[model samples]
Target: MTTSEDTLESHEVGLAAPPGEPLQTLTAAEADGLELVHQWFPAPLTVRDGSFALPPEPAWRAVVHAARRHLEAMVGAVGRLECPELGPLTQCGSAWLIRPDVAVTNRHTILSLLDDVQRGARTLRVNLSAEADGSAVLHCPVTRVLYIDPIHDLAFLRVKQRGAPQVGLVVVDSIVTANPVAVIGFPSHAEGGYAEPEYQQIFGDGWFDREGRGFKRISLGRLVSTSDTLLEHDCTTLGGSSGGVIVDLVRGSVIGLNFGESRDRRVNLGVPGWVVQQRLAQLEGSI
Candidate 1:
């Protein structure tokens, strides 16, 4: 009994005794749960990022199908905001849903209309369409300003609706240049001062045709460069294209928003998604 007691004490202290002694190490299950320590030196290791391959037709098909579903949801989330006159006047810029009832858009879209709303003119009604059979069309009013970027041309508004299908914002520490992106939104055909729209005829403004998910246009472009404070690109766009989502297809999320374009419509600028994420944090209570 005394010898057995001594062995027990030694084992408790992580030690082994004489012959027939158990090893001074963890059991198989315990060792399996612990990972071996990895040592690193400053100069040996290099970064190797893993990426997916969708080369095969089946693989790419699944990718496109998923992206299309999100795109259609985005169309339902977008709404046409017109300056509330006796009747709907000129069509303003676009906005996409970030939250169920809250959306982000260009600051210019709501700035001029702010005065009218303040003086009890009328709420800015956002017209959203259904995704099936044109079953219903919703006109939600922007009841509050959520957030606005200081230097970037972006704004967030809360609509008076319980919920709406939304596209998620892809947040990342840094944006790599020359990454391919999809500029998804409803673009206008007008160039000479008016929004002479060409894409909204079949589906109407700010909607997706439920019949075949028709009328949603996507412009392919790549990140040109990230200059000091702006994200530049060479995507062709029109006036009504402002506030459209800049989607990163491979990541399957919105990396930024196309808010402006160069005079030639070649060098477009977008508000990066990181900026939007930061602004949302500041709007916690401002609701």
Candidate 2:
């Protein structure tokens, strides 16, 4: 979907922190986590046939091995959806499996699809994979739009499961400032003039597809602040990152759902994990 300037401006207005709240500095552990992320990617190596070239350094390989399980979990849990009506290459947004047959994403991302479903269209599908060899891709048809959150940007969907792994969730009560986190999803160009240049610098020219979008990748940052229902983080995100999970690097569990960003891109916003848990519980009870 095309993101208008007005839409981005609205995000800035709503996500901007209340005046006078100070930003927190990263702790030693947080710094170590961020350093590990840097070591994992290093620089824009190259892209071949829509896949990234592995860094050959033994040290880089060691880091990958150390974090392999978490990294794999990130990619396995999150998947991208495409809606031809939205645009041939327009990714609806990132959605992560919460249950074998249930997924969560931004309401805005599936708004058009919701309309189409009402008119008897059934074209939505989620493409998921757990292996880098392209050997285990799972294409699950989205059966229906389960619910559109009345207050937040969250939405849920029912998909035909084919062994998709669900991500573990940690309630917000356990999260704290300076906890290092990562956002995993498909990121397109940053339309707000915020993260595009940095993305280009880090990933290089070969990183994007013909339509200028990057594949599943991890962005590292630490939680800056939180409230009853919202989480503010500095994780670099773009247009298509909506609904991506904010995972605690140390715990390897999801703590938030990405939804919006400040105009400056320094502050990204997400629905707190507890809020998501509560919503899902309500939905389950009603069903």
Best by lDDT: 2
How far does residue 216 in candidate 1 sit from its true spot (Å)?
4.6
Model 2: per-residue lDDT, tens digit, 156-202?
Answer: 88888677355433434368565567676666654435345544455
Off by over 4 Å in 2: 1-67, 85-87, 130-136, 163-173, 190-197
Q: Per-residue alpha-carbon lDDT of model 1 for 132-190, expressed as tens digits?
A: 23445566777876665545677888877545444434445366553556565544433
Badly placed stretches (over 4 Å) of model 1 are 1-66, 86-90, 130-135, 162-173, 191-216
Clash pairs for candidate 2: none
Top of the candidates by TM-score: 2
Which 10 consecutive positions of candidate 1 have the poorest summed lDDT? 38-47
**C-alpha displacement of 155 in model 2, angstroms?**
0.4
lDDT of 1: 0.51
lDDT of each: 0.51, 0.62
